[model samples]
Target chain A: MFGLIGRMRASPGKRDELVALLLDGTEAMPGCLSYVVARDPVDADTIWITEVWTDEQSHKASLDLPRVQATIAKARPIIAGFDSQTRTEPVGGVGL
Target chain B: MFGLIGRMRASPGKRDELVALLLDGTEAMPGCLSYVVARDPVDADTIWITEVWTDEQSHKASLDLPRVQATIAKARPIIAGFDSQTRTEPVGGVGL
Candidate 1:
């Protein structure tokens, strides 16, 4: 499994725009399985995205997509900070 | 808003027990707003918890509670890796 869990700090007065881009851009990527952007109930500028893709290759390809790249281009300065970490885990759990 | 976002890597054979403890203990936290334990659909060893509390005081107290602490003591080696990060954000979202 491939996933991206991270936070994006949007620029002043730009949270809505970034969220819009994400919501709209994500729909265009078939490789994307599940993508959720949850804004902090208290912090308007903070956005947390939990994204899952089919595999590492799909994740890489999604990033290279025109829509994804375009969204990033439109996001630049409006974003204060962006950081993420990726991990892969095996299927099914045995521990109980 | 106060929230705890982190991953808990359960021991090779202890994921169920840990999850049970969390599920049971969280219900006892009056300060808790929301507590969700999501296991990686792909990784059985991975557990992600998104917990929101009233404040730092509540969060700390919850940990000090008998059940919560007892759960931890019983969880030790059963957990392979545990790490977490904390942050606070003001409420309401303006950006759109």
Candidate 2:
């Protein structure tokens, strides 16, 4: 499976709004096995997204998905910067 | 829910071994909603563990579990160092 783990810094005081945008419309993602949005405990403005996809192609394809594109556009303003991004290969584990 | 995302660096050539140790016996962990072990695509010796638990107490209690403790003991030598560890509050997602 393919995985993408990323940390994003939201504009100050906009973390919750950013998170809401992320969680919205995720139910329709085709290749998504798991898509979790989490808040950084220490840094209130930081958010972490953990995604598991069936394959890399599916992940790449999702970017062109209208809902995803729209969400990205909506979130662009509140997104201060990406702190880290890691692509991963998930071998085996629960929830996969 | 409580979440913990961590990056661990394994001793050279021991990434697979460390990953096996982490995946072992996770089925029995109570209150664990999701537990995924992934390998960093760029770094052969780096692994990321993404976990979601029912609560912080459940996560803390899991450390003392016999299977978990044994795995920790076995993994200690091969685990070079932790690159990052972040505690999180998981609001909503597919896996959970």
Best by DockQ: 2
Supply candidate 1's per-residue lDDT for B15. Answer: 76
Rate residue A17 of model 2 by lDDT.
96
- In candidate 1 the C-alpha lDDT for residue B29 amounts to 73
lDDT of 1: 0.64
TM-score leader: 2
| Fnat computed for model 2 | 0.78
lDDT of 2 by residue, B1-96 (tens): 999888899999999999999999576888888899999999999998999999999889999999999999999999999998888899887767
The residue ranges of model 1 lying beyond 4 angstroms of the native Cα positions read: A83-96, B1-6, B9-46, B49-96
- The fraction of correct interface contacts reproduced by each prediction comes to 0.03, 0.78
| RMSD of each candidate relative to the true structure | 7.2, 1.5
